[model samples]
Target chain A: MAGNVIEINNLTKRYGKHRGVEGVSFTVKEGDIFGFLGPNGAGKSTTIRSMLGFLGYEGEIKILGSDARSGHEKLMKNIGYMPSEAMFYPSMKVSEVIKLAADVRGTDCADEAGKLCERLKVDTSRSINELSLGNRKKVSIVCAMQHKPALFVFDEPTSGLDPLMQNTFFELIEEYVKQGTTCLLSTHVLSEVKNYCKNVAIMKEGKLISCGSVDELTHTNSKRVIVTADGKKSDYLYKGDMNSLIADLSGKNITQLDITDPSIEEIFMGYYEA
Target chain B: MITLFKHEFKQNLKSLLIWSISVGTLGLMCVLLYQSMTEDMQALSDSFSNMGAFSDAFGMSTLGIGTLKGYFATEVGAVHGIGSGMFAAIMATSLLSKEEDGHTGEFLYSLPVSITKVVAVKIAACITGLILFSVITGIFYISGVAYLGENFETDLFLKYMISVLLMNIEIACICVAFSAFVKKNMIGAGLGIALLFYFSDLICRISPDLKDYIVYGPYSLANATEIFVGNEIAASAYIISAVLIIAAVVTAFVKYTRKDLAS
Candidate 1:
């Protein structure tokens, strides 16, 4: 049986009148790709920040079976974090930047970095300022993965990446998971979560509204109904029996009717609205 | 910590070079011009000394402009003093705040190193940069004096340079303290602080009533006229500078350690 790699309990952070996160609690098992789902301001980053010991919070957080804050420096040696927007000194080349991070970690990641750079198509000689957004993200990916950490925390890691690069990124992540790595992935793309993540926790307005296995959350019988009748179309999520839905719509001058299962995004939106 | 220090020092090395070279060259040129302006300076010195407060404010009366030492005091001293102060201020002010303002803290603070350690290393780097600036600028001034073959008191010049370095460290520490409290890069504020102390020092010199309070500002300790004429800087000025440096460093460390870094 796999043990929990990350356990956060009753985590709350507040600044002045602004609320960062409230009563957030969740756990990620070892070797699991845990999807953290939320909108732009839904406290995903705040939780990640607190877990990384970047911000002080009221509650308990344990990473790799040690207190997160007390053992931050030790735990960080085994954690790789890729921030939402990758930024580096404009004058430094990508290779220099990678070398600095490796030096900070006190490890020589040259061979792994070389492989990742080649796979990601990142130019090592180009200065950071000269690289495009996607290329910078690729560099960030290399930095995060080159060390082969036990846990990976990536926030919106694929926003600027193209489809091909995104695929390569996930493939790399999957390979790491195969080697007994855990990942806490925060993203807005629900399709990625459905495709790659086994478990998920959904947040809304600084609160975790739903959390469970991906199959449990998306296994509901609710289907999206799009009805075009009387020269007008009506679209909404329907949870009633299909016969009842058809009987109710039979009296209308229905030109077209389409019913399909709701994707994880729609299911998660239901929680947000609720 | 060493890696961070090296990176930070390299990052600001260009700015350091530009500032030190420009100010050092200016100081050297001022020293070289003394010989060419000897006759004109002699003619102006007598009248200048009789100008009362105007001469006193600029040290023309106390340190006469006819001699090389006095000329250097009244000219190169002011240039180097203001230049070094501004350079130190500008460099230290944005040293820490730019990390937050530019969103680089997200990268730095995420590393295994503690925030306290990072802050300490950065302050050390700032002080090291100031030391190098002093050394480079001092070499330029010494070369100028040596090349001219003029009779000058090396002791007084060294004392003045040491005091200037202390004054710069004082300003840099204060700005570093301010950097911890601010989220944006405050280069303008840093420059303003250097100018404010300078003009205040000038005002104190011009006004006899304000003379007793000269120790309140950093410029008093580095005053060219005072140092070149072998006048002792008030003991209270040194005490105050020591206190300010300690207090500012303590404030920066405490504030930054607990700060919720802006993302």
Candidate 2:
């Protein structure tokens, strides 16, 4: 279905003795904000690289229902890749780098680039080397998204952004999904993925340990209790016997309170501990 | 491929302009001094006696410096041909690695182009740049001869230029291959390999039997020197060297495309 933006099956990549990614499998629905959460060196980059056809791996990787390796040309034009390390020709100005990518991707949208520049709040005239690390990332993001690719495969996409820029980025990504674009957001920083991602894949040691909707993991793995015994703060369970009391009232809504939702991190941790 | 090629070609052309200006000035300056120094009859004789040993060592006088080809082979060839040839090699080495070093490999590889096409395009661009540099050298040779007047020998000029051009290509290809095999910036490896091949050619000159091996070096290409001077052109030397170049390019493409951008 055009509804499935990305699908992986038993994907495996080996770098001599080290396996880059082993038996990695996941599916990204069309317009889905798919978060890939893993610790550093757990093959988040490797999986993304394979899907992007940067490295050959032993697995079935299909992007937008096309085999990623064999039919990569079509996929490449539609996928915007923001690497963990922000990369551009140091000699090139930010706008020029964006233009060069536009040329390669064969997109005639220079006017739109100006608008993107305004939206991202990135100055395009600055040479790449002159930009701070966060600014460089902004440049890369602009270059990656200027063509409005159907899929955004962002590896550590918000690494160097300030808090304000990070919020703006989330808004833009949400706007993209509204237009039916798929997002495969890869990062070890799970808290960031929690707010935006609908579907989540938790990776551990080159393998997909658990995958589901963020809501499912949040509800099933961990939950917060709402106690209403008395008006005073001391009346509520604080520790020791209170823990057992909560366990006694487990799976019950004993009081009126907003249960603390489990962030992606807690669920990711639960995949191992559970 | 075309876009990246254009970019590389433009960058190299910038380097070529600087090279032509500096090397051409120094070479022409030397030729001017030669014209003035050779005018005195007594000085000419004294000069020959004084420089006989140096000339033999440099392949200068015996090469017939009065001619444009010999003048080019010694002066311009030494400066531009050998020096710029190595520069071209280093250029090829750095071209792809720059993408990796700058952390642009993910972005570059993610594009719709294949690595083989990228490598081929970069080499073609560099080759075109080398050709442009050669043409500049040719123009300078003509201008130098025009300045030197009756002392300039035209017979060997074209031959020597062609020889130097081929030597430059040979060295450039050798260095390109070295760069392709290794990951990251390989300007050092490229130069090291190129110098090794260059020195081996000089060593091979010590034995008549090893002369066949000199073509493997950057300086061993058949140019005007052999054809105009009645020396054996060493047909097999060119044939073997051409084979080596082709082999190296093919090997480079294979290795480069296969390797991951681990850096």
Candidate 3:
């Protein structure tokens, strides 16, 4: 069995009267792309920040079998964390920034950085101030992946990326996952989770609402129902027993009936409503 | 730690050069002005000394302005005192706060470095800036005196320069402590503090009742009039400066290590 790479238990953080995250717990197994799904104010970033030891929280968190708070420095050696917004020194060139990060860690990532930059199409000579948001994100992606860390933590990584670049990012991540790297992807895009992630944890109002394999969470037995009865057509999401849905519609003169699995997006909305 | 220090120092290099050059040029002008104003200064010296509290506040009563040493003390000393203090204040005040203000702390603190280590490196860089500022300004002053071919008291000059550097360091340490508590750059507050200390020193010198209390301020240790006239600085002045510097630095290190960064 694969060991757990990240284990967070009963994590709680508060900003005075405001809630950050309350009793949030989840575990990501090694080599798994764990999706962390939440809306704008659902505390997804808070959980990630707490796990990375950026904010003080009351709970137990273990990354790679070490205490998150006490083992921060050592843990960071194998962790590549990309925040929602990538801000670097404005005066430094992308290449210089990459080199500085590598130097700070006492590692020479010149070859890997060169390859990543080329693949990402990052303009090495341009200063950070001159780059657009998408270009800066490209630089951020290269910085995060160039080191080839054991675990990757990306918060809203695809927000500023183009569709083509987004595809390239997932491809790179897939390659890394094949090599046994674990990732905690925090995003609201359900399709990405459905396609790339094996397990998922959905957060709402600073609490974890659902967590399980992607199939299990989205497999809420919900289906899209389209029926035409008495020359009237209707379409709606149906949940519960298939027999109950069939029995209710049998009494009516149903001209046409269609049943199909609901998309992950609909299923995700179902969780929020539930 | 060295990597962080080097990066910070490089970022601050432009500000350091600009401040040091501006202040040094002002001091050099004062030094050079002594050559052209010799006769006029000699005539004004007696009248200036007789002017009661005004002359005492600027040290014109104790030190004659006709000579190079006295003129440098009264003129260049005032310029360097305010200049170096403000420079130190502005640099240290914005040192740590800019990381968060510019939203760069998220990038920096996420590295494999502890908060204490980062704060220590920043403090070290600030001290290095002060040292370099002094050295650059010192070169300008020495070059000016040499060009004028005047005989200056080397011992007194060295003592004055060292005291000025210490005073600047003391101001910087306090400003660093202030920086740790604030999220935004407090350059205005830093400048205000330097000016406040200066005015307090001037007031204390002019009033006999406030003279004993002067030891509590940084200006007490580096009074141009005192140093240029070979007057011994009080032992208490040095003791207080050391204590304040240590206390401020310790406070800053502790506060910064505990406080949440604005990421």
Residues A126-233 of candidate 2: C-alpha lDDT, one tens digit per residue: 888898889988877887777888999999988889999999888988888898788999987778768899888888888888889987766652454455533422
- The 10 consecutive residues of candidate 3 chain A with the worst lDDT sum are A137-146
RMSD of each: 1.9, 4.7, 1.8
lDDT of 2: 0.72
Q: Report the TM-score of chain B alone for all candidates.
A: 0.97, 0.81, 0.98
TM-score between model 1 and native: 0.96
Pairs that clash in candidate 1:
none
**Which candidate gets the maximum lDDT versus the true structure?**
1
Q: Candidate 3: where is the Cα deviation over 4 Å? A: A228-233, A243-256
Q: Least accurate stretch of 10 residues (summed lDDT) in model 2 chain B?
A: B41-50
Query: Which residue pairs of candidate 3 clash?
Result: none
Q: Which one wins by DockQ: 1 or 2?
A: 1
Residue range B41-96, candidate 2, lDDT tens digits: 34444454356445443455456655545544555555654555566667667766
DockQ of each: 0.66, 0.54, 0.65
Model 2, DockQ value?
A: 0.54
Q: Interface RMSD in Å per candidate, to 1 decimal?
A: 1.1, 1.5, 1.1
* Cα lDDT tens digits for candidate 1, B1-263: 88989988998899999999999999999998889999799888899899998899888888889999899898999899999999999999998898988888877876778888888989999999999999999999989999999899999999999999999999999999999999999999999988998899889989999998888888877988889998899999999989999999999999988788788
